[model samples]
Target: MKTTLTVLLIIQLYGLASCAIKQHYFINQMKTWDEARQYCRTNYHNLSTFINEIEKQQFLQDAVNQTSDAWIGLNKPSGTWKWTTGEVTTQISWDTGEPDNDFCAYLHKDSKKLHDRDCSNTQTFFCMKVTVNTVMVQQSESWEGALEYCRHHHDDLASLSSSRSMTDALSKITGAQTQYVWIGLRFLAGGWFWISGDDLILNVWSSAGPPQCPAQNQRCAALDKNTQTWTPRDCEEKLNFLCFK
Candidate 1:
């Protein structure tokens, strides 16, 4: 029994360390998207491209410190967005019917999605080193409090976009976990969606399907580590959570 407990502890710590993300610099100075790109290339890696909530939160926190919206590495100038480094990764989480008639984009905290705007619009920007980190919050708390804890300590709660990502996150669960833990899944704007603005393409809800749509009383979602399925629970329900950084 002691050996088993030791193994679980080791796995938990190793999971957190394995997903650690690279650092980023918050340039609170407002600049055009093009200008920001040049500045990032010259001084840092490049305009930040975030594939998951962990990276997105890093930039979002930086943006909040500034006075206005901020330009990220995401842009759909012409049609599709290409990172500042010139690689065109297919992973894109767009708001409903977005990426229309715009050359540049900025991160919106309210919707937590890429909103297209004129490239010339000057805004603060973020430059990231390109990395990902995952952390498990063993402290039980309500969903809202869990969010606050994540923001105050690491990033936001873990958001799963793809099956691979979800599976990877589930693997971090070490010991036998009977209770549900909070994730970034929630019902918002008339549909189930990830807090990171990622589309709700993959869902492993209960056999009877997920809880009723347009959830009642600010209901949030949690991950059943044992079953690896999602379930809607009261926002006030205190539970352990997962945070990505």
Candidate 2:
């Protein structure tokens, strides 16, 4: 009886260990911001969606062995905060007074704390790929020029009818930080609209607000630098655009 009981206890312990969540890491090196993001989404799951405090703590602990910073799926284009995974940010784990719309998001090496960064700057990043494979691409475009550029190259700016579509798009183009691309979206007729003319459904505007309708003189849209939200600006203003095929 004693031997049988010991065997059963060992079996129970094994089952508990099996149920524990498995954490994986990818120490990607020498990739642009966009490329790093794409790598994580395509190779792993969506780029490290840290929704709660526990996950954030675990991620930092996991990265304790690493020496460089890693890139999570947080970016501000045209003044809107979005995850490369395509799911809207229902919850966030930013450090106190963080995501101030400075420009970008980075994970510090020592503290593993995430910081907002400028999109133009370059940095190394770590990508957390999940067991479930998903991808998405959220393009940022404002004016007719950028819109035309995307239409000419990739499909219209990004549209997410469901979470699956968002994940698929993100997986396709993970690493991007080199050049910004254009999406199939713009401010038209006093409202936010997609190139497909779909209703303004998924609103992810930053702190400021949505892009205003283009004025007669100003025929384009540009993201506000301070707020990281969309606003009406001259299309002629030069800015890097995001494109996905």
Candidate 3:
């Protein structure tokens, strides 16, 4: 059986893992904020928008290059800051004394924080593609088999890295044939990890909490449909599973 100590060490790196819940694209070409937005919409989904600190940190580590300050998806329209998704800016990652009455936001490469600038200023920008589509496969298969199936047919096993993704996954599993369904979560090497390489940012474990060290065969994670929580289960057990596409 795997020991709890081994698993705990892996949990410490949960937030450091990389996955495709959100993808950032750096555009080196200089363009005005409006021009950058149009370019992003034409090529990618939109300009980048960080949903939380974890995402912000991950983006800095994964995408930001040696470029200077760059345009993000934040802009003041009608005297209010909003993301490219049209969501009003709530959580702030502003640098010291920022928003200095400017109408557009740029991310400083050094501080990795948001600062306002004139909308007409030309700069390289970042674009992002956000996708969290989860599909429940009613076919029952063991954890390992399911992983292979998903990798062959779809993107990978579903990774609920956030509350929104969790909710989205839940919606697809309501009609699942099994009470528990395999997700991308698995205890491997020394810790539990998402097979899809996603960072485990959400805490949706059962009331009993995650097993520190599961038994040799009970190292895989499954989602409890009725309770909407995660639980360790035997990897060999056959069950329905979710896939990302």
> What's the lDDT of the predicted structure labeled candidate 1?
0.67
Query: What are the candidates' C-alpha RMSDs?
Result: 14.8, 19.7, 12.3
Over 81-199, each residue of candidate 2 has an lDDT whose tens digit, in order, gives: 66554333556656666777675677777666677876656667666644322222244333344545554665433433223334454444444331332334444445554443223
TM-score between candidate 3 and the true structure: 0.53
Q: In terms of lDDT, which candidate is stronger, 1 or 2? A: 1
Residues 1-245, candidate 1: write the lDDT tens digits.
Answer: 53344234323321122243546666888799989977875565567775555755765665555445678787764466765433344656667887778878777656666778899988888776534555777788877678668766886677765565566668765442337888877664466766654446565885556566644654588888877888888877888888887
**How displaced is residue 195 in candidate 1, in Å?**
1.2
User: Which number leads on lDDT?
Assistant: 3
Ranking of candidates on lDDT, top first: 3, 1, 2
Shift of residue 52 alpha carbon in model 2, Å: 1.8
Candidate 1: worst-modelled 10 consecutive residues by lDDT: 9-18
Point out the higher-scoring one by TM-score: 1 or 2.
Answer: 1
